[model samples]
Target: MKAFRQANHDLNSEPESAASILQSVKEQELQFEQLTRELEAERQSVANQLERCKLGSETAR
Candidate 1:
């Protein structure tokens, strides 16, 4: 009887466990997206700075 009750409890908890994992994955995905956008913006800023430096050198020469 104890074994049977344990099995039933496990079966009931499976859905809740799955739901918790799903929520964690969704939060991670949102964080990943925000990081990607920030990285792209940083990359663009660096490229612009490099271009300015190159133009400055050409003008000085």
Candidate 2:
């Protein structure tokens, strides 16, 4: 009976452990997505600046 109770307790804890791990994974994914967006925005801004510089140089020439 004691062994059965211990096994049941372990089984119950397993789901909670899995849930915590899954939550952490989800949070990490969100952080990665946010970082990707920020990087893309930065890339776009740089491209725009480069285009402006090219236009200014052409006008000067």
| Candidates' C-alpha lDDT | 0.95, 0.95
> Which candidate has the highest TM-score of all?
2
For 1-61, candidate 1 gives per-residue lDDT tens digits of 9999999998887656768999999999999999999999999999999999999999999
* Model 2 error, position 15 (Å): 10
Give each model's clash number. Answer: 0, 0
Candidate 1, residue 35: CA error in Å? 0.5
- For all predictions, the C-alpha RMSD in Å is 4.4, 5.8
- Once superposed on the true structure, which residue ranges of model 2 sit more than 4 Å away at CA? 1-16
Mind sharing the TM-score for model 1? 0.72
Candidate 1, lDDT over the whole model: 0.95
> Per-residue CA lDDT of candidate 2, range 1-58, in tens?
9999999998887666768999999999999999999999999999999999999999
